[model samples]
Target: MAYKFALCLTLPHNTTKMKKKTIILLILAAIVGLAQFIRPDNIKKYENGVKTEDLAGVPKEVNEILRNSCFNCHSSSSELAWYDKITPVSFLVASHIQEGTEVLNFKDWMSMSIAKQKAVLYYSINKIRSGEMPLSSYILAHPAAKINKNQMQVLEAYLLSISARGKTDSVKLKALERDHKWVKPALNGIAYMPDYRNWKAISTTDRFDNGTMRIIFANEVAVAAIKAKNINPWPDGSVLAKAAWTQEIALDGSVSTGQFVQVEYMIKDSKKYAKTEGWGWARWKGDDLRPYGKTINFTTECISCHRPVRENDNVFTIPLNLK
Candidate 1:
């Protein structure tokens, strides 16, 4: 009799436990369903509000490749797939579009300077040659966008003129490196960034720094400009206007020491931007590389987050002149 009574009591407890689990599962299901409804696939293009000119003096083959393969993300007109409308995936697609548009927008290609126009073409050719563009993830989805070695070479050859012009900037880069003095400024002062669209943080490149000061490139653009014919305006904010420099270090066996000039800039246009749009710098000491020292009392909304064209070196305008 005692055993049967114990069984009855235990049965109710098990029943209650199962009921709670069912309720929890149902709630989770409902939450997921609601999330799908809330964040449906809705992608939109955000233009820098500039216009583009006609394709002039560009190879027809190169133009077709860009429009069919790259334009979806790199241009204003994104070819949204049906999968883009699904949950979770929708957010991913939207983010890609946002980031891609932020870096390079084909819709607004005419606003850039002639020097920049040439730079864009060369950058694209390099990106293709290095196989760093059309992103592997993108190519996985769209196999047709993939190019052969011959196609890549063809595009590169077609861009030889633009690349030739980009070579002129190498002198400036070399001059800046040699002439620029190393000034270690405190990181708590005002920082200035000219345009929000063309800014990024100082990155620590292990490849360039020999594991020391960590080579940093700043004031970089995010994407290569188009060189296709009739593609003008090329975007203005793609060019960064601010102070950019690298740091040097002295080291011991176990510890690293010394300081190099970080970065400093004053707001050139105070009326157009807010105090948040000020000057800032970063210091790299050993492994603890963060924005430190004296800084101007300004916010870092505009420049600190601009997408980089290179790995992390914000300044992508500087073409690697192999020509």
Candidate 2:
């Protein structure tokens, strides 16, 4: 009689547990079902067409690789899978597409200038090489988007083939020696900072697209921020200067900095330049130190190009740790 009573007590507890689980499962099912009815507002049915012709001069193989891997997210002619249409997941896919297109859209390939196209291609390759492109989450869902070593080599080779290679012109080298004591300010009101040459070198980069090499320098305030590892917001008064020069390739494939091409600066002052994302943007192109842009609105181009790295405080260079 005692054993029977114990079994009866346990039965009710088990039954109650099962009932709670069933209720929870039902609630989840209802939520999922309701989500299906609500689609993302930005999600649109992408046209199932491949516009390979838009990339006219791109090699056939490269075009195929881009179509298979990048076009879906980077172009207007995206081809979506059945699973990508599911709610919540579809919303994420739409966001990725929106962000990807904003950074680099192949649909506008023909519209870009030759130099701009090369720069875009170079930037795209860099992203791919860094394992940042075809985002890990994206590759998990779309296995075909994963680029292999061979595909990467093909892209690199194509870029190198198009890159300008040769000796630098002596005339341009001589032109860089001119005095810059009275350089004019950019149309946006940021004056030329000649003393940036004395700043500490923070990082260096090679621009394969434009066939130039660049050195990034940080002013005293910027350097202090780097040392403290407090560069995300990069405290007010921080200044960074990037000086670019033509790349001179020797017969043995060694590359050296040649004639000075340009120097760009980013000054930080959150309240002072609140309208321009808390940074003063200015660029002086060529040895003559002529300010870039015809009007004050030139900052639009700077903001657009740096938009992809907005998370990095709109700065691209990752400063090396200082002692």
lDDT of each: 0.50, 0.86
What is the C-alpha RMSD, rounded to one decimal, of candidate 2?
19.2
Off by over 4 Å in 2: 1-7, 47-54, 164-323
- lDDT (tens digit, per residue) of candidate 1 on 1-323: 99999999999999999999999999988886687776633364322322333344467887776766677677666666666655667777677777777787766555433444456777776787688887898788678778777777767776664445565655654343332122223354323232332444333332244433432223333223322211122233233323323433435544332343333332223234333332222332321123443344323432555334324233323323211
- Candidate 2 lDDT over 38-140, as tens digits, reads 8876666453445435486689888888888999889886788889988888889888988888888898876554555678889999999999998999999
TM-score of 1: 0.38
Model 1, 77: alpha-carbon shift in Å?
1.7
| lDDT over C-alpha atoms for residue 315 of model 1 | 36
Total backbone clashes of candidate 2, pairs 3 or more residues apart or in separate chains = 0
TM-score list, all predictions: 0.38, 0.48
